[model samples]
Target: MAIKTKNISPDGKRQMTMQQFTAWLGRFDADKDGKISRQELADAVRGAGGRFAWWKCRQGLRSADSDGSGYIDANEIGNLVEFAQKHLGVKIVGF
Candidate 1:
């Protein structure tokens, strides 16, 4: 199935400025955890009008989890953003 996404531009692209991404991470990174869990990602994806696929989400996490922590931390958020923009066609605005 195709990945779904909101917060996209009318140009048919997912747009996420660094500031926007950081703010979004903070909201879901509840429990004061430094990392984002798969469930959190799934919730966020769903919230963003995207379909949640466990394997796909895991793949995304793995792609960005540079430290192999199974979670996306601040240090790895850039990687996550890159992955989203690259494979998912998300445009990192204000880059």
Candidate 2:
């Protein structure tokens, strides 16, 4: 089925903007290495009050890390947010 952005959040409370996604990505860069690892992504999501399985989070990071560097940057995070918004139907707003 075709996915739509509007289908991301049903309550319209978790819609996250590009800026917010970028900010979250920055915060997730725990080591400040300009990239976020699988663990870092999980920690970042958890820290933001979002619950996700560690393995799942890791898998997501791995899938989104297009450069094969084992890390995800702002662009990757943005894509991830868009994917989550489309699939999870959670309006991920600014934290």
Top-scoring candidate (TM-score): 1
Give the lDDT of residue 92 in candidate 1. Answer: 81
Error of 2 at 42 (Å): 0.8
In model 2, where do residues sit more than 4 Å from their true spots?
A: 1-12, 86-95
Worst 10 residues of 2 by lDDT: 1-10
Q: Local error of candidate 2 at 49, Å?
A: 3.2
lDDT of model number 2: 0.61
Colliding pairs, model 1: none
Return the TM-score for each candidate structure.
Answer: 0.74, 0.65
**Model 2 C-alpha RMSD to native:** 7.2
Q: Write the per-residue lDDT of candidate 2 for residues 4-66, one digit (tens) a residue.
A: 234355565455566655665576576888877888767755654555648656766766887
Task: Please write out the lDDT profile of model 1 over residues 1-95, one tens digit for every residue.
Answer: 23334676887886777877667656766666878888776655555555444655677788888998788888888878765664455678886
- Model 1 poorest ten-residue lDDT run: 44-53
Model 2, position 5: C-alpha lDDT score: 39
